[model samples]
Target: MPTLKQKPKQRPFCFSVKGHVKILRLVLTVTSMTFFIIAQAPEPYIVITGFEVTIIFFFIVLYTVRLDRLVNCVFWPLLDVINSMVAAVFMILISMLALIPETTTYIVIGGVFGLAASVFCIADGALIYRKLLFNPSGPYQKTAVHDRF
Candidate 1:
């Protein structure tokens, strides 16, 4: 029997797969954006990368603070998966665009980072999808152990 002083041990968010992916996403976003800016990439590419960086930053803070648990109205994991998938798609598109033959060295570097980010995004989405499938959460969650049949 544990005493009142012995609180349940909780794993840090940074140690989880989700957290690792999120951090990777943030790093990639910032790095690519930096390279893109330095390379003087097109306005559209810069704007798109900026938008993605903002979104990724928002999700990082949301998960880090455990706000997802507080906001019962939203299915955060699903939203995160959707965001990751969308970001991956956008990143792939922009990365391809940036990697054209006439592009500068910095642009090529940015494109490489962008491609890497997209791969990580896809991985993140897949991992979250598996988690949701195996361990359902939210209001309508029903586990096999609870079933009487």
Candidate 2:
């Protein structure tokens, strides 16, 4: 048993240093957009968004290297891909609507951003947790779903 006074060992976050950089990039991308940035539809913004998206895709495609045959096959990458997609969707919507004259558009952008961002953040945390906390060998194991059963 671990002592209450002892600190838990720091777990490696699921991301490589490159992965950490991508995570940081996403954080910056989400926070960097302002009403003004969204209003202009600046070329730089589009470029940055595109770059972040590409990074997200690369992470999903490459995520399997760290994870083995157990739970990593589908679930981990699936969760991450969904998380990135949801974030991108809101960011896109918010950017498109921020310049519109309608107040409802502003409300919609804010509301969706709030909701989607929450889920994205949770998924991000879970990815890190899974990288650090999950075990491949255990008393409870991953069982394949049989099509016939």
TM for every model, in the order presented, reads 0.82, 0.31
TM-score for candidate 2: 0.31
Q: For candidate 1, write residues 1-149 as lDDT tens digits.
A: 87568787767677888889878988997899999999999987789889999988898788778898899998888898898899999999999999976479999999999999999889989877776674455446556965856
Residue clash pairs of candidate 1: none
Model 2 segments more than 4 A misplaced:
1-40, 64-118, 134-149
**Candidate 1: Cα lDDT at 103:** 73
* Residue pairs with backbone overlap in model 2: none
How big is the positional error of residue 37 in model 1, measured in Å on the Cα after superposition?
0.4
Quality of model 1 by C-alpha lDDT: 0.86
True-structure lDDT of candidate 2: 0.49
